[model samples]
Target: MSDALVILGAAGIVIPVFARFRITPVIGFILVGLLVGPYGLGRMVYNHEWLTWVTITDPERLAPFAEFGIVLLLFTIGLELSFNRLWTMRKLVFGLGALELLVISTLLGASLSMLGQYWTGALGLGLALALSSTALVLPIAGTHTPVGRAALSMLLFEDIAIVPIIFILGALAPYADAEGLDGLFDTLWLGAVVVIGMMVIGRFALPRLFAQAAQTKSPELFLAASLLVVIGASLATGVVGLSPIVGALVAGLLIAETEYHSEVEGIMEPFKGLALGIFLITVGMGIDLTMIWANLGTITAAVVGVLLLKAVVTGVLLRLMGARRSTATETGILMASPSETTLIVLAAATDALLIQPGTAQFWQIVTAIGLTITPLLAMLGRNLGRRVEPVPEIEEPESGEPPVIIVGCGRVGRLVAQMLTRHGKPYIAVDSDADMIETCKREGYRAVFGNAARMDALDKLGVDRAPAVILTMDEPVLAQRITRKLRAAYPHLPIIARARDSLHAAELYRAGASTAVPETLESSLQLSEAVLVDLGVPMGPVIASIHEKRDEYRERIREGGALEHKPKLRTSTAESAAVQAG
Candidate 1:
């Protein structure tokens, strides 16, 4: 068979599944690269020989495309970053990041340096350990809350820090080389100039470029513009002596400022998904199961020790920075995985010959093994959440009767809570949005910021003690989720949910909410008819008219069957019967 066809066949087979396996393709690609190269099924395309060879023989030819994948990945990262968000996240990103970087690096570096590894090696180890896997964590984060934002920002800070670490590693090259300092300085200076220069350029020029592109209102052109910005920034970063990932990140940040940020992200998502698929698969394929088994004891010990250290350190930092205990713990768990980017740095160092190839390979293999252990650690965090008692307690004011606990503090939730409050009924509000929680608190109301889905948050809000739950979030799906969680945890707890319409309310009721108020339709209609009757309209006719209307809607929605364990209403109103059927 011809060499060209062989490589083309391999590329076709591999690239198609790249998106399917997600980040695992990076591992697949590496393994496939190894297999196709001299190591596995040695189909040596060129014997260190031909110029025009397709795959292995054409390293220079393949380099740009491989580099493009990295560029795309960074660009996605940059696009997600927002300066306003970062400003709000100063504590988590800067304060927690610094504490994590300094403490983890110092402790690990000190331990390794004491054990006779090169000080530089120890420093690198520390840095790598301090950095959590963005690929691993971000997907888990997806689009949650303050936690997701915090995780992303911390990852950003770590990615940015890599530029300087590259220079440091570069500096550690043989001192005997007279030009070593000059080389390090040049790299550092080049990186600074490029990053700062790009920020200036991105702030000024890129927005206009994106605006011009967006003016066409073509998804294709918008996609093209996003691609151009990402690739251009990435190439620029590469030119200025940094990884293409940095350029991609810078590109993302710049584009995030554009009017078309969401549109751009939507357009670029497929590319990001493709790149990430390859990245994850590559990670999975590089499992190094044998090495992982060999160092099982050390890896296990290191994982535990590092996790403990991180949890304690992160928790302390969070508490010190005024974060709630639950927030701090969630942060620790999310940040536990040692980042894949660390391996990238290790690879770069090896490529530059600043560190032995073995050093990079060892950490890479260790990291791969470490990734395997993350799920277990996350589980442990879940099971062992809030093990230590909170120092400054945030308990609700004790009441005689069980309080109506609202799971969200949005407009609807606040209104419901205020209604209850005005009636001299006790209630507590919980929301994941920090600003919403703050606003609720300032209004002289009881509210806590937390994830309603999480047990810790529910527990904090005295869910165990509460007799009822109010799901007042605008999103009916979210309301249903909160209802289900509350029902499962407290089966007897009556759940009243606000739904957009009767259909949504019915769905919520089926999802275990005792009563779902479709404000726009059923509830409003019932209340309006009652108010009209009170204003001396014919009461008997109005009551009979609405009663019939309510029954039909009830019958249509009640097919899901009885979800009630216990009766929620004492009065046999038509709404009560419908809720019971639900």
Candidate 2:
């Protein structure tokens, strides 16, 4: 209970405090763990008994929760991916991901062997260090951009390879028998069966299960059902001698296929975040400051050696695989660190007697340091990538027409695109929704998949070259943010945004949107126009009066927002008027 209190208190303090400084909360959690864990303040408790109340006396008790945090992380990753999307990246997953793991492990192992370790011990170390931190890397890179996609492909392959890597470590044990290999073969078949069974049964069962939960209109019950599925799936895989995360991932994939995935994702997000914090905290607790200080020279050399080897190997492979230089460089750096899973592999190596306990402890400390600095590595990679290629090398449109860029592909965005098409104006749409992008493509619209919330995606779309940009997503905050970024980057580029109401319109205008079209105002104007036309007003005069009212409301909104200048009208609107006049 004291331990739980300590963790909760740390989260309460760490998250907001770090966020205020615009820093990642990950560093804060790790720092809190370092401060409060048994090796830190807990060390003073023997002399100062009162310290026991505040510091974590039992780090072991938090292990299960921390592991569950990883499980939830995998679960969410599964939710973000569908079977089709996974299949689409099969070449990157199996080819690049496989080669990356094997090459890095082999090179590192050979180096360790030359340094006087036995081949078995070196191999164990090599494999352990080859893995990258999916838990840390994915959230930072996201699964959207070229860098994120590349990272996700490699990480997904690594996750899938964990069981096999462990099996190999056990097989390499000096006293290992045929029984261990037999068990592995049994696990392989059993895992396969379990996965297929879950897919078949989950497809039939999950929708009905969630439907029953949704009918209750109870958030608590919904959460209970979500947890049950994740736990049950995780246990199934664990029982079959596979990783519990496999089960969690399968559970998430199943839920994702159902209509309730979004709701499930939304409800489960807070739990996933808290659990992940516990995992990060546990990582911090593992760092033995005294041990690190004593072996600082050897540990530093090992960390730097592993980081460089992994980064170089991964980057070259990505380049050969046809990734852009910037993407390859960024992804290589981002994935250079050893993973949270590396610690697990280290534990396995120690248990199998492949590596000494002392050696495992040394490397575990190194892994912790690697995890702690992942965010810094990411920032470094991003800046370096920008320096390497100031502008992303995006492919130009085939038509040779300068396309108007649409930042969303939703209903309003689609309507805007239709009008552009009707006027023979070239345009392209970008959206974060994969399904929406596919739909747009099938309907003969030029669409790209990307998260417009990030400027990288916009830059890749050649936003600077585009004649105009439109923001049509319903998210007010996101729209405003993108508008601010676009305005700052391209001061003269016209930005038209959809607003929920007059207030939202004002906010978007203040955020640098050239024009903010409020749905409420448009609906009101349409209603007034209909009433006048039905009462026998001439159609031409009614249409002119509607446009006049819209302009009037737009002026009022801009004035209310305290804007000093009335921005020029959109170029597209002027062009349309010119064509009509001609």
Q: Which stretches of candidate 2 lie over 4 Å from their true place?
A: 392-500, 503-516, 519-582
Give residue 26's error in model 2 in angstroms.
1.0
- What 10-residue stretch in candidate 1 is worst by lDDT? 563-572
Summarize candidate 2's per-residue lDDT along 70-98 as a digit string, tens digits. 99999998899888888899999999999
Please give the lDDT score for candidate 1: 0.66
Assess every candidate by TM-score: 0.62, 0.76
Off by over 4 Å in 1: 1-77, 87-95, 142-153, 175-178, 305-311, 348-359, 389-415, 426-582
Per-residue C-alpha lDDT of model 1 across residues 1-582, encoded as one tens digit per residue: 333453445555666786575433334444554444332233343454442243343233444444565566656665676767657777666766766678777887787689777877777777777778766666555434555665666676787677677666656655425464576678677878988998887788977887788788787887777778777877787786676777777778777887778888777777665555445434544555556678778767766666677667766766777766656677777677677677767765665565667667667766765565565555555345445423233456566887878878888887888799788788888888765776577567788778887878788767888878888788766777777877787788887877787678678877787787667765566677768767887755665666666665666556542443322222224445455766
| lDDT score for candidate 2 against the true structure | 0.88
Cand. 1 TM to true fold: 0.62
